[model samples]
Target: MVKGAFDGVTVLDFTQGVAGPHASMLLALHGADVIKIEPPEGDWGRALGELKGDHCAHSIAFNRGKRSIALDLKSPDGIAVVKKLAAKADVVMESFRPGVIGRLGFGYEDLKKINPKVVYCSISGFGQTGPYSKRPTVDGLIQAFSGMMVMNKMPDGTPWRQGMIAVDVTTGLYTFQALAPAIMRQFRFGEGCYIDSSLMRAAAAYQGAKLMEWVFSKGNPPVLYMPAGSYKTANGYIMLSAMRPHHFRLLFELIGREDIANDPDLQSHDNRIRNAAKIIKALNETMPQKTTEEWIEILQPKDVFCERVNNYTDYLQHPHVKATGAVDWIEQDGMGALPVANIPGLPRASEHPPQQYAPHIGENGPEILRELSYSAADIDAMLSRGGVRAPAPAVKAAD
Candidate 1:
């Protein structure tokens, strides 16, 4: 059996985009019965994705352990349905713009009235009370606005957003942390509070060292001081992070050059900066004498740290990943094997298949209302009043 930690908690997840979804993804894996609340046409992801065999591959990957419910909160009937669902829910997560949910009558305050103990978490761009609270943001935009981009730019000076959505991941982890404490609060004191987690803020927090220096010292902390990043070798690049002075001494000695190591100008932090270019040039020249393998063999023996940067495919196929059983595979009807990256402790194989794909718009609307004990007449009335609309594609088997 797939044993989980959060076995009995019920989560009404209204999060979408990246960060919020990843936060709930972890909860679902740990056995929270997360009901994803999509709009009548479904979450924008299902429609706005790059498709593969039977679904949006990205959405399927991230939302593997949750159930879906399509609801149109713009309508009074739909909003009332949500209030009822939230009444029994232990947690409610929403990533809407600051005032959007309030205008729709499903804001944290409104939900709190229904369930005063609900751990309500709001994930947004800037936060609930900031000047940019309602600024529409995506991962790339926030990376730019938060200065994460500048910290990891190209040698030529053009900043780059990372290949994957880094800010989203940071924000998601923050959301999970916030929800955990709130859930613990409910268990300990019988009350839960709201968490205002902003993806922009989390991204900035992750890059605080670089950001703080720019704000306080007015420039980038030198590559020489932090001694962060890669050095080219005969065949590939090996990372170096000799942030401490003693380590710099050890690293210089390993490269077979102790002349500059104890030189008066390179002896201390301030002295190193006064002679930055010379130190960087000597290290670069010495690095290429050995391949990454040779450097690893030499430095690791002395405990002077270094690592080879691996690409995503390499990381997924690495020995540790396979040993940990970190990825799960499924067989689809016509498509070849689909691999779902499974977090540990979830049943690797089982009677229940991986969550069948993101639900079509309103595909589960009726069932969701019914689960909340809504009468058939009430559901029909809501539909008649435009509380929900089924996606035309869902009506047919294929799109």
Candidate 2:
């Protein structure tokens, strides 16, 4: 049995929703003992989309491979339990609004006193010290504020957010990247650090090149390449990129528009951009004559970078996807079977069964309490007093 990279690490996770939980989930998948501290009701992420028992798609996707304990932060007993956990944790993460965790006595500064080698990470919307730091925000709000909506404008020029929680997921990845290096530094130098991660910063970093282009071009960046866009076909759509001059020429020739390919005015990329309307109009008139699959078959052999616009179902069932083992089907507890995409650098879900199970709310409370040296009576008292919560015993089927 080979150990994972973080096999000896312990993480105390007090974050909810996508970003923070996503980072902790990655840690758990890497064999860290991640203790997810949630409110009695559960992490609010579990309420995203349709709920299935104590889990939702978003929650399960971002919270697998972690033990859970539901606790009321306002209660003294709950705070004590967290403090005890913090003392032994190699890492601590929270996603509270600025100053809230500090007031609760679990901020980086507070925890550093008890455990100097703890790498504490705080994730927020606007970061720790800004005028908008306290302003409540979610993935959509960050998308709007960070110019992602503007960047991803519809053809009609309407600013629209992405269909998915792009900013939140990206923030989670950035947070994990930050934490990994900090943990390495701690192990090497015996010094702890604080990570202030935010959706705003992560979103900005994600669009760094675009921002630079905006500034350099004074908000009028030139088109990257000519004849690079999605065209409607008879059946559906095909996105093609004839970025290089030779590719552009080849595309026109393949479409049986030899006159357009030979046109001197549209030979260069700059001229093509200037006469984009002409090129687009020609493509629009011709593309509808063929189905997306037909166009793919015709253009792919000619070295055109083209792909059929696929929905989720199409992508999931793609032959290449299956051949590459890109997704693994797992029986998620309470949620039944689901297709889990394998992370590029991590082991597949089938290789690590424990990492594939997402815990229900407080699902491991009694076991965690026992590890913390709490007696059965004390654990029962905490549960009875509403300071802690554990899942109800499962009812057996009639024999």
Q: What C-alpha lDDT values do all the predictions have?
A: 0.76, 0.91
Clashes of 2: 0
Question: Can you list the residue pairs that collide in candidate 1?
Answer: none
Tens digits of lDDT, candidate 2, 202-235: 9999999999999999987777887889999999
Q: Residues 272-391, candidate 1: write the lDDT tens digits.
A: 777877777887888899899899898888888898767767777889977877765675433346666665545663334654344444556777777878899987887788775543
Pairing residues by index, what is the TM-score of model 1?
A: 0.81
Output the number of the TM-score-best candidate.
2
What C-alpha lDDT does candidate 1 achieve relative to the native structure?
Answer: 0.76
